[model samples]
Target chain A: MTTVAPETVPAAPERAERQRGQPRWWLYGAAGVAAALGIWAILAQMLAGGGGAIQRLASPLAVGEQLASYATDGMVADLRSSLAIFVAGWLGGGILAALVGLLLGRVTLLGRMFLPIIEAIRPVSSIAWVPLSIVWFGFGFSSKVFLVGLAVFLVVIVYAVDGCTRIPGELVRTSTMLGMSPMQRFRNLILPGTLSEVLIGFRVGLMAGWGTVIVAELVAADAGLGAHLMAVQRSYDIAAVMATMLCFAIAGFLMTVVFTWVERRLLPWRLEEQR
Target chain B: MTSKEAEALGKTTRPRTGSRHPLQRIGLPLVGVVLLIATWEVTVWLNDLDSIVMPRPMEVLRALGDLVVSGEFWDDVVVSLTEFGSGYVIGVFAGVVVGVLMAEFSVFRATVHPVVEALRFIVPFAWIPLVILWFGTSLLGKTLLVAYATFFVMVVSAAKAMQQVDPTLTKVGRMLGMSRWRLAFAVQLRAAAPTIASSARAAAAIAWIAVVAAEYVGASAGLGVLIINASTSLQTDVVIAGMVVIGLVGAGVSAVIGWLSRSYLSYV
Candidate 1:
């Protein structure tokens, strides 16, 4: 392999610059996890024993048990709802963004005319749109879907437009000289050229969508993991709060895992050659 | 910023499309904004919507004018800026220290990386509920939340940047008999500053979003509180005005970062 994955990729030339013998990284990794858990448990105990307002902090084991208890039907429904909103928004927004971004990138006057408007509104993130969404559609499924889609749309569109526009001038010129039809150029040249970068956009957009879900649910939602977290938090059930957060973490991790697998499968060269 | 992120940040004016006359480039976008405003005004008038439900663009502008004259707006701005500044400074400082340590010293890398990976997936914004419960919607919890989000971005970007700096530079420093610390400061840091600074900018923008979220859930003051309170009261104009301020301030933060990078990191 030419390189390791993003985090692990440091193992190459960086190894040469070490001041001494190579560190036993795996041992330290295991030690780090143990130390983290140990410290957390200790902090929980101290808070509990101290008594007072801060005494409600839950231990890791209690959080684990709380997480397991969430295997009930309601919990399943929450996960399903959250995932459904996320998948629908992500797929819908991602595909729409890919099309719009490609069109804008290919047509220079359009990108130029529209780029300023995007820049103006882009800073007002999906979270800020909560006020507008609530005003426009109340706290319904459509509002949440709109927020998530907008978040993904804003992020993915930029990456796509930037990616497609950066395609080599020589390649475009060569294709034109060969008298390729617009469809042939897009299908054979633009599609392949932008695929890897577009995938990168998709991964980042997943993060945007996930974060927006929490914001949307926090505003108002009858169900969903975010709403569940708010409910538990209000009752001061620290364990359940931690457990819900764990579910979010696990969900995010699984999404990334699935995405990375897809990314590698689709573009093996990208994984091997990324700097 | 990663090349990708920077591309997103400063992609406003495309030199690739620079062949066109400058006026058309400027005028066409101005027309789009005018068209949008005209459409918005017409839609409201034709539908006969109340200002509370859908404020005309002119009403929103008037609300913004009124907001700037009010004392509460300035107060909210002060509170929000204070939280953002403190969180961003502390977060970037700590993140750079730890992230560079992680990349430079294998011990830190091995010991801390797993813990980071373990917790990284927890949406930092999700901490809002617990933060409100624990810290009671005060600046401390808000600052911590912002710092938490900023810290992760800085740490990861800084670590990757340091690890990826040209190996030849470090080799030269080694040959010059520079101390390890000297090598890091003189060679590694200079090379990594661009990414770190850009990522810090990205982090600052994120910190604004976090502060807004934090304040929205429950807070005594801030632009978020302004938006939340206004929206609840059906003061659509005020809500939109708050949003405009948030957007402008967010854009200003990014601009400041760009300026800082060019001025300070120009040596690169």
Candidate 2:
């Protein structure tokens, strides 16, 4: 094996330079203004007997305290429960999506047969499946997994199918010329070629799964972030609600970033391609 | 502001389509669907799956027909459609305005960009409880929730598209003594039409999620309510029927937007 020199890839100094060239202070000023405006809007709405929504938002310090207490309190356990469900559901869905996508992508007959039903069902939001999930699996992990699985399935399949259909004609012809069997070509070329695109689908699916989970938890859930937030809202605890949403937003961002990092590490060659 | 510049700018942008056999383009998806339904029927018959748990295709169709004939179902459809439509239009408006502003302004993009990105990652349906608390199960509440869901998605897409406008077009407009406002409206906006159209399609899907979630909460009339009611009653077929309608409506909206996007491309 020969080592490929890093410099063999295109330089990325321009991207860094562009970032440096952009004015940072002005952007922050505008953002500060926007945040102030947002605060003002909430305050205005709350001050005029807005029923304390603004009053609730006014005490970010209090909310920050609440967040600290929540972090120490059952928040960790609650987050764990939700995260556990999220991981289980996402993994199950990811595996199924990848397998189905590969099969449909590789087999012409299977691709032709399943394309219509898949397309028809693809557009349906996973939230629409909540009722059916509740019916089939009851109000538990099974239902959550099913909903997550369904939502992820559609997105992944679409990307995977597109990836398969995008295989270069010349590559396929060359593989066949080398006496590669249909199965061999699928295993060696089609699947590998589509890996990057399929990974993108997985990322999209994971985020979509988060949204689906919220809906699922809304309908019937004993312990989860969604249920937790709903509890705070019902009690008119606006500060707590906002705090929970903050936690959720932060967690979601971190999760997506982690996935991106993992993708970069796994597909180091992508950097070269991008350059 | 200048017709000559517009015409020249338009000539540089063209769509490239990949090659595919016409038969495979249209025939495969159609044939695949028929075969899938056939397979579904066979599986149900062979396994004797309970209709309550997993309804046969015919049962689902029959249930759909029954619902379509009912006035209540029509009411639900109307409610869902109105919520979806109003929310989508408002979301697109807000998205486009903010996207354009952020793209055109340098400082504005930097400071708020992080916040917008953070908000985008937030689960859309998680806003439902707060919306209910604020607006109290009203039409306003649901519409707000839908708008919240789609707004970030469309804004990000639109803003990125705006940034990608050919600098040369802006240069040409400037050479012709075009004002910044005119250049933005006549050139940047038109150039970003395709991207905006794609974003709108994505926004529709996110909007659908929001509408359904809103209905699932405390909605009195909507397909979401019907599905929940059907589920409770163990009317799996009716629930499936609702799913079918939602999927079809989504596809229909996307197809229309896609056509409009193409039309806009030609116009520009």
Candidate 3:
């Protein structure tokens, strides 16, 4: 990992070329996947219910079978509903947070007045609000959306506020000294200043929103993956439950992948830093 | 504790607020609270909302007061504590063991790291239904869910901390003729302790959230159970009260972790 002098920079590619002799990472990674499956298979065998229909732990293959079934089953509707709830909640809360965060960061009077209250509420986990949201919005999409939004809002607001307030004093002074118009200052200074932090907010908010959405759905949803999970769980179909979880994990991973891709596109300089 | 907990410390402030009058420092926030309460009460009055639809601030406070004195609330709190404590300990212990293995052995890193990383994408709450099916509506299922939630964060943090141990220090250990295990435990793990321990704060936060979700799955007793029951019964005040209690406890846990990290643990 140590870097050589500028003259040695031309040799770096050769060193990387020589690294082809090293063990391939993906081979080991595939081994890792196989190992995980093997372990699950062993657990399923060990925990298999008495010769009958019940199996407490579903084998990886069984879950795969269930997932295959989902290709022609209700997974689409469930995924769509879940994604819809997640997107609405995440974006709605994120936009609101950006506004509130900017306000808190800029206005001393308002910040002083509301900072403590926000702090007090900050520690409350988003899941704790699920019941209250249900009480307020009832057992429907709105309730789940509110719950997710609230969680995302709380998570993002911190970043938003920090983004605005943490703009360097010198930067502010320089912009002011330039006699820039309000819109000019906002365009040239504020947008770039807050973009990174606010994006980080969105990233964190996504996790919070996703988690809350699952909890909300589990509690009382007519549709969505969580409700499907509840139905299968009550039926004691361990394979289906595991299959549903696989769907969830895949979805979560895809969302993260999308975010990382978006981040790289937006923050190309970060990628350059590595090279 | 990472940026999340650091931000939770709320250290950022207007540059000039430090020298502000103490009276104004506290009074301004109090005014905000008063306004919030006024707005809540006014909204209820304006809507002529039913208690089930929306509880007034006073009603929530009264419910909270009652919860504080009630044995049921205490019992639920005890159940939650046990579930969180046992599950977190198990998850952290397992995670650190596996993480250390990955650090010390390339085979482990190759075979387990990617698998764990892939699994980490799944929210722990998603496992609650599966665990319930496995262990039923008992404490074990709840504990398993919390543990599942805690495992990934700790594993990643522990591995990262171990890997980040100063290479020069390890070389020094080798020069001193320390055994491999001795070097790992005495030098590497000790160096990694602060980062790993700081990670506990974040894992604990996740564990707390998971515990609520676990209880929601099918626990007979918990803050989550209380909230769920109240919601089902259309007792909005009690539900809000439960939320307040959960929030207070969650904050207290964070504060306690912050103090521990500050006082007992030193960063390498």
Reference-based lDDT, residue A73, model 1: 40
Each prediction's whole-model lDDT (CA): 0.80, 0.72, 0.78
> All predictions: root-mean-square deviation over Cα?
2.9, 6.8, 4.9
Runs in model 3 deviating more than 4 A are: A1-23, A50-55, A272-275, B1-19, B266-268
The lDDT, on a scale of 0 to 1, for candidate 1 is 0.80
RMSD of 1: 2.9
Write the residue-wise lDDT of candidate 2 on A135-252 in tens digits: 6788898888788878767766666766776789999999999999988998899988777767767777766777677777777768888788888887888778877877787776
What is candidate 2's CA lDDT for residue A179?
100
Instruction: Please give the distance, in angstroms, between residue A72's alpha carbon in candidate 2 and its true position after superposition.
Output: 0.9
- The lowest-lDDT stretch of 10 consecutive residues in candidate 3 chain B is B1-10
| Candidate 2's TM-score on the B chain | 0.86
Clashing pairs in 3: none
TM-score of chain A of 3: 0.87
Q: In candidate 3, what are the lDDT values of residues A1-275, reduced to their tens digit?
A: 21211001111244335434565755876888987889879878987854332247788889999999986889999999999999999999999988888888777789888877887786677777776776677789899999888888877888887888788889888988999887898788877777778887887776667877778888885899999988898888889988998898788767867886787789877545545
